[model samples]
Target chain A: MDKEKYAKLEQKISPKPPLLKNVIKAFLVGGTICLIAQFIALFYMTFFNFTERTASNPTVATMIFISMLLTGFGVYKKIGQVGGAGGAVPITGFGNAVVSAAIEHKSEGFVLGVGSNIFKLAGSVIVFGVFSAFLVALVKTILVKMGVVSW
Target chain B: MFSIYITSFIVGGLICVIGQLLFDVAKLTPAHTLCILVVTGSVLDGLGLYEPLIDFAGTGATIPITSFGNALTHGALAEAEKHGLIGVLTGMFEVTSSGISAAILFGFIASFIFKPKGSV
Candidate 1:
């Protein structure tokens, strides 16, 4: 068989993922996480003197905390496997990344292993997060100073 | 209130769908996608765009990593206003300290207790 024919033959035999099922699963799981977060924020707003805007910080912190606990118990990995991007695209995934790295590297010893490698995945997140924020802030400040756009 | 909930759900779900598309079509790694999201959030927040999104979508907008970046920038800018140049140094991390510290602390404890399921 020619190369193209051989490739097509191989493609025909390969198992296809259930794309629709996975999308539905992802949508449900992701929406569930956001729903929980929203509830938490509402709780804070109702009981604590926080407005909708102010409640976000505590809501995110609580979600990350819950994710870390789940990661510790080895539950999050299962979630990631089943939920795929649904499990990961939220802040919980960020928690999983940090804790999983630390767990993976724990055998190498404390400071160098757990400490250093803990941020291996998340470090990029923080670095880029801060850098991007700085750049945008700088541009905003310049534009405001020059009166190019009034804020 | 009901409309807010519906919008939040749709927006949050859509963001995840976009992430899924990136993973499937673009084959971007999770880390790369996350970084991109954070950067996008920061840029939008800095441009004063994300605030409106937050107003419209609430937790739908905030639960994503982009909101974290948005909070960092807003915190730093607020601090810079109060403390001048010194605020720039202390502001960003201060805003995010709770989340960061919690992750580190919980991660450290979890690592100490849990053994790897597979070869590290």
Candidate 2:
């Protein structure tokens, strides 16, 4: 069969993705995760010396820790299946990435296996995050020097 | 105070929705989606917009992976403002060091105690 004919046949037979439903699920899961994080941030603000601005640091760390537990227990995968990007888009997802990679490579011993593979998914995040952070800061520094904008 | 909760939920959810669309419509992998969002966050912060979003949405703005970029850039810029050139390198991780450190420490513990289960 020609490529166009095969493409048409494939399109006709393929099951449609439930885009709307998936989007709603993602929003709910993602929003709920943020709501829980909100409370965590508030807890830090109320009980500690942290202000609203300063509270996110602790809040993110706490969320990651919780995700570590969830990932370790394998519960996070269920959440990921249901929540899709909702589960994958938050700080918890970053923690899950680290833990899951570590768990996957546990057989090769700690040094060659877990240590090297621990960052397989998340290493890009840190590298690009820091690199872009440097670039942004560089631009802002030049802007400040020229009085184009305040820091 | 009450409005903050609503804003956080809605805004945070919307960010995820955008990611969902990227997956379904754009067909990007999770890693690519995350990298794109992080860079978008850095661009927004460099444009001086993300802080206002944080002011508007509270945890709504901070909880998403995008905020990781925002925090890192904010730290670098803050240091750059004070110490000029070298400050950027020093401050790149000032705010996020705790989060990364916690992940590393917990990762070690998790490896020691936890076994990977059957595939989900």
Candidate 3:
């Protein structure tokens, strides 16, 4: 049996993400958010008993907590304006989804408003997260079955 | 240590730059762009490529919303390997449970404390 070339396989495996300079503001904002998150992760590791792997969960929690406050204060919207996707692409964006939707739908009452709409923006992300995982796993499982790869 | 910060910033920034381009040039909404990035991240991780990127850039790789997809896929694949096909379904949310749970809990609480200020 013949195997594919490694370079060709690399192309098949990973799509090249864009590296072109588009908006400097987005770059700065997004990068800054991640950098801050790195610090938070470090803090968890330093002060707590979290390892590198475990620290991510707490770090993400803290960032979302920060974003929830910022969104309530109307500050996150400003950051979204300045940063565009930068503002919306981090875990903070998930916070924005819940906070913004809850605020926007408050007049509709609590059960219908906050409870239902809290996940309005975020629900799609979750759907895609689960759906994509299933699809990719299916493919990987098939590949492993074919003996082309291991798990 | 210093290098970790630099790479994290640059790679993370680069990802956001791509997102900006999707908005400006591709004309996709933020939702669509995020969806696309998530799929890309999952596909890449399935191919065994995203781990290297994560290894190199640290939080730069993990902090993006795309990492959610990566984590989900990683969990699913790991579970599939360990416990067979059924694990694929079960393990998908294993690692990503925290981010979504935190967002929900904090968003609910914060909404009570702070009413929405209208866009004045």
The true-versus-predicted C-alpha distance at residue B89 of model 3, in Å, is 0.6
State the weakest 10-residue window (summed lDDT) of model 3 chain B. B111-120
Candidate 1 vs candidate 2: which has greater lDDT?
A: 2
Candidate 3 lDDT, A1-151, residue by residue in tens: 2355776887688755343434788899999999999999889999999997788889889999999989999999999988888888888987898888887777787789888999898888888988998999988998898999986
Task: Report how far residue B23 has shifted in candidate 3, in Å.
Answer: 0.5
Give interface RMSD for all predictions. 2.2, 1.1, 2.5
Q: Model 3's CAPRI class?
A: medium
Off by over 4 Å in 1: A1-19, B80-90, B118-120
For model 3, residues B1-120, the per-residue Cα lDDT tens digits are: 678889989998888888888887787888888888888889899999998998788888888888999999999998999887898999998988888889878877876777888773
Cα RMSD (angstroms) for every candidate in the order listed: 3.0, 1.4, 10.0
Give per-residue lDDT, candidate 3, residue A99: 83
Cα displacement (Å) at residue B44, model 1: 1.0
Q: What is the DockQ for all candidates, taken in turn? A: 0.58, 0.80, 0.50
lDDT of 1 by residue, B1-120 (tens): 857777777777777777777676677898888888888888887788888998998888888777778877877666666775456556777667767887788889878788767422
In candidate 1 chain A, where is summed lDDT lowest over 10 consecutive residues? A136-145
Q: Sort every candidate by lDDT, greatest first.
A: 2, 3, 1
State the weakest 10-residue window (summed lDDT) of model 1 chain B. B80-89
Candidate 3 reaches a DockQ of 0.50
**Candidate 3 residue B12 C-alpha distance from true site, Å:** 0.9
